[model samples]
Target: MRIDRRQLLTTLSVTAAFGGLIPVIGQAAGSRDPRLIVIVLRGALDGLTAVPPIGDPDYASLRGDLAVDKAAALPLNDLFGLHPSLVNLARQYHAGQATILHACASPYRDRSHFDGQDVLESGYSVPGHTESGWLNRFLETLPAEQKVGSKGLGIGSTTPLIMRGPADVLGWAPSTLRAADPDLAPRLMDLYTKSDPALASLLDEAIKTGKIASGQTPITAMGGAGDPKTMVAMAEGTARLLTAADGPRVAALAFEGWDTHAREAQRLTQLLTGFDNALGAFETTLGPVWNQTAILVVTEFGRTAAVNGTQGTDHGTATMAFLTGGAVKGGRVIADWPGLKAAQLYQGRDLTPTTDLRAVAKGLMAELYDTSSSALARRVFPDSAGVAPMRGLIV
Candidate 1:
């Protein structure tokens, strides 16, 4: 049942022959659906901080001094409240353009962030040896012709392992350089291939598209600045690229600095602000195509339900995943109802996860690419047959 490198590549080719690649071109005479964007928030965002529980009887006591005032929280519903810093997303939610999945996490139960991320991205129950991510696997399932053009894109200094696979892929990092140096691109490609075969193949594809050697100015030069702002600008750039006629179909964007172990208020606010801006950029840039796109914002897991002695939260269980875009069936918080009671908490420390994050991901993949849950479980997220893909996530 284990997939090796070569077999994995072959599987991609076969999958591409059937499943359609994303970032699909112009709306067909009868076709309307288009693209999907995935944003991964690293460092395990504290869902309780981002979206507080204003209705939970024990919420204030559990969060202690770190709890945000009801006045400061943007009311999503009478029960669930959003951090004031997420005004942008809050507006989207109120407008029926965003939805939240609460008390959710990857099947992995261990506390290691690295392993948790691996399980989250690799779409596997266990870590240490997943070869491809569920997104890439979804790409593989697309029709061969649909798979044509640039492969998946990774934004940031390093390509996430989630987006790495046999499929042609590309990497873009916002830099201060005015433009890509024609000579430097091929040299860099050579270096990558020599150092890492996987990255080499990816770079080769990027170069062939003339995207790498186009001498295009760095995205940062186009007004991108600062930590979270820079990240949002990166996402804006990604949305622009994905919407292009000749641009990539699938893309992966990662935002760091969500680990709020201390100074939860200030740090979480900044992180959520950055996320809000990034999402706003995507919505604004996508324009009319926005309705055709679906953006899934997810994290490795949630932090402890109760604030710790450090004035922040620690890695624990459960969390929230956001689905936004024109295509999302929004204006609702999706969950299996795991309460925040002390006895209800996982290990009596974290919010007990009631919904499997994989189901949400699978639901999106199924709707966007016409892939089935069976394939998702068998090839994309192995041993997840017990987890059915949730429906009604797409408009």
Candidate 2:
């Protein structure tokens, strides 16, 4: 399907209007204390591969060929082990700067990326109805003055659905090596507004800020040129912008290419290495502000608990959500302990979800923004009053 930028903006405008009703919560007035960054890992992430359970008695048996041995995996704790390629993240975990939420997922149980992302970002109980993201709703809830013009920023070629909300939003991608003619921006904006008012507004804002709407080669560029290494480069660039003095307080980014249908080991290793480098970049660039920043890395869902015929995993349930930053209460794996035994698996195929991903997100919002749990559940994530915000996720 073709991606329509204007249609997306119009939807966001409508959502923004309704989001204003959400009650303000979190962060006291005049507190520029914390920054929040969310990285969306599109396509299902194989949590079993990232954070292997080397100590689980049945893990090796269940995973069989996909199982990673303790000798090869990077040890995170006595019970959990990380992929060897994720050495940077493992170091952070040891330094008390990272934590993993294993067997966590959105309330949705389906396999569609669109629906899963909708539930994850919209904060609504159901999919498609949530026009705005929980983050935008949180921004709307803030007292009027604290709501800056651009409270949200999106990185990459096209903005992810999560950051598309009514709040003032800014988008930035690295400048293309070949610059466009100076007049091209204004001309494009004029054409867009005349043809589509909603798209016009978005393009106008982007143009006014001297940001390009397109042209930069995304890390996903093919031919191996836009592989994991390029992805890390993009992350570093995004981190630099987020940490800037006048930059946005919150941002969202998405990285694709995690769908490992075959040759899982080689592909997963390279991807994890890229992920590790990206985390290192954020830690380095954020510098002092890194202490106050919290980064939540999540995916739409998890892969199957058991390997498929192709030696790959299928769309399943209960993936891992990674939390890192100076503010995180780190060095621990948070889970309610759903064992990997055959009968313990959800639907007899995937790991059963013990923690709602939203709870972790709610906790981050509450801690970083000082928002109240009540508001987070009721307003940010509608009809989510029962899913209390997790505690001690951030220091």
Candidate 3:
């Protein structure tokens, strides 16, 4: 009954269900009606390889086996180029629907995946300081009667901690989601029912909420969640829901399997391919709404700059973040471009982070939701008073 954090996530990753949505019955339109999606690539992503700085003198030397050939890359301006796996993203860049944020990191500096994700999603300067997520808090700050509804959604097998809080959230994952252990659920519940009542109660609530989500509207999203093979289906299903005028207006999703400490060249290719395909599905499935939406793709952290003995990158600091969709002011690679020199690296190994991701996120939040800077700092991202929201990200 006392499940470890890792075990709990492993279990939830398989058994996905839903909770009720506070119906947005008459989805009124306005500047605030714009769509925004936050995609958290759970595992660390190699910023150098994904958006190579072909112009940097040290890039090729540091990357070695993992270096992408600029000749086959998709040109993004004269310096950075998109990885070949990012074919769809390349086309998006050309169409002015994409922007990449380089050398970015959350406040968390260590290489622990769990802690890094904790700070990234929780919106705190340090990990483990807060229990609720920033997104959930942002939802809580909405004017009680203004526009609260199913517009807030989390799509995956289990909702990311970022989407868990007071907000009335709707969940979507593949209906075929199976349990990690057929008897695990019952056994856990029984153990909880007798000993840890609080934990047991939460499990009960999730189950009941899942049932409440049944029969209202079909889980039309093809892929459901979590399974990599169904990535496109997940994107299509997300778009299907977002397109419904009365359905969700803002959503967040998480994709896994990015921890590429070995066979990175081949591993990253498949991951990027899924990412590209998902982007295409969003454009195709959302139809006209695609123009009004901006998708934010981020990872917990970036891998090391130098390739290891295994020809893969290890955990490091500073990576890339992406913003794409019709709402974005695209055709730009925004980065101070911290040099790859030994002195330039953070602690002499990873890329030194030059941008605080909170600023970029605050900027987009203000543009789409018109949430004030004061409120953004005080409510949405507490203790982040000095980190000003960025400008010119959305038009």
Candidate 4:
């Protein structure tokens, strides 16, 4: 009973926090007042499915069962089409508030979700290269005069490693955390192990679970750590906090469950809906500050181009990047157009990455915050001198 009650409380806290009840404290926006939101899709998102390359002669054939039906895809251009689930994003694109960056990826190419996410967030050419996040370092680059002497407010339980550099960063999560007691974790884990064995095994994972399983319902049913409503509400809270004239100007959000190893068609469709809705919520909540904002959506890596036997995809390479907000130079599917033929595949299985994600980041930071590419390579993204910022990312 103790375990069950604890689990219930845990879920309740998430409900309350995500429902916009908690006010997260963060670094006040600097003098520039430019807001940047980085939403990390932890699981390997299949770029092909999210932003389908229908015009590529090999796309449909290579994708097999995992391919999004071009006829149903929302037309983005003569070449690419977005999945129906991303209706909000497509609308933003039409309004010139979004841009689709195809065949983009971080330097990490391995399939491990942990490592991929680390590389994606850490902004390193290799994993474990930095103790801090690129965003944190980006914040460090801001003129001391504009910094406003603030730290970041992470939206989840433990502060993520990327945000852990020299700069101070605070964290916020759904919790009933009373006065900090050293024995809390151990006691909770002990109780959880004795009560709910399944939930106990993933104590850390529990902190991020979108929904708790009951009865015969599988835990796998929850799309990511966040459910659609929770994600939307989280966005609402973010907008509220960020829109504050004195609120933190930068934030980091992570959403998982892109690992569609099976039944990807069904799974991805649902996840995409969540993604679309979250973006919509941000737009609605940001209000006047929307014009000064730039939201960058990126994934660790993309899934294979070819569908597996179970109508899903394996971890591959090269996916799409999404940017939306009033500050972005939108209505363009930016790419070097790597053909999806077998010979063109990264390893003869994945889409070939044509652009570096760091370059995109460089462009945004340089353009929005008046950051320079030289400084971006030197300070923000260490050893990223050769990779030039993809120009024209910001208006």
- Per-residue alpha-carbon lDDT of candidate 4 for residues 128-197, written as tens digits (9 for 90 to 100): 6646888888877877656664566455544555565666554444333332244554676698789888
Candidate 3: minimum summed lDDT over ten consecutive residues — where? Answer: 19-28
- Candidate 4 C-alpha RMSD relative to the actual structure: 8.6
lDDT of the structure predicted as candidate 3: 0.77
Off by over 4 Å in 2: 1-32, 175-177, 181-226
- Rank the candidate models, highest lDDT first: 3, 4, 2, 1
Model 3: per-residue Cα lDDT over 201-319, one tens digit each: 65654443343333233343344333455677667767766766556677788888888899999888988898889899888888888888899998999999898998898999999
- Best model number under lDDT: 3
TM-score of each: 0.84, 0.83, 0.83, 0.81
Cα lDDT computed for each candidate against the true fold: 0.73, 0.74, 0.77, 0.74
Q: Which of the two candidates, 1 or 4, achieves a greater lDDT against the reference?
A: 4
Q: How many residue pairs clash in each candidate?
A: 11, 9, 5, 3
Better of 2 and 3 by lDDT: 3
List ranges where model 4 is wrong by over 4 Å: 1-32, 174-224
Candidate 2 structure, TM-score to reference: 0.83
lDDT of 2 by residue, 112-144 (tens): 877888888777877986568887777777765
lDDT for 214 in candidate 3 is 37
Error of 2 at 251 (Å): 0.3
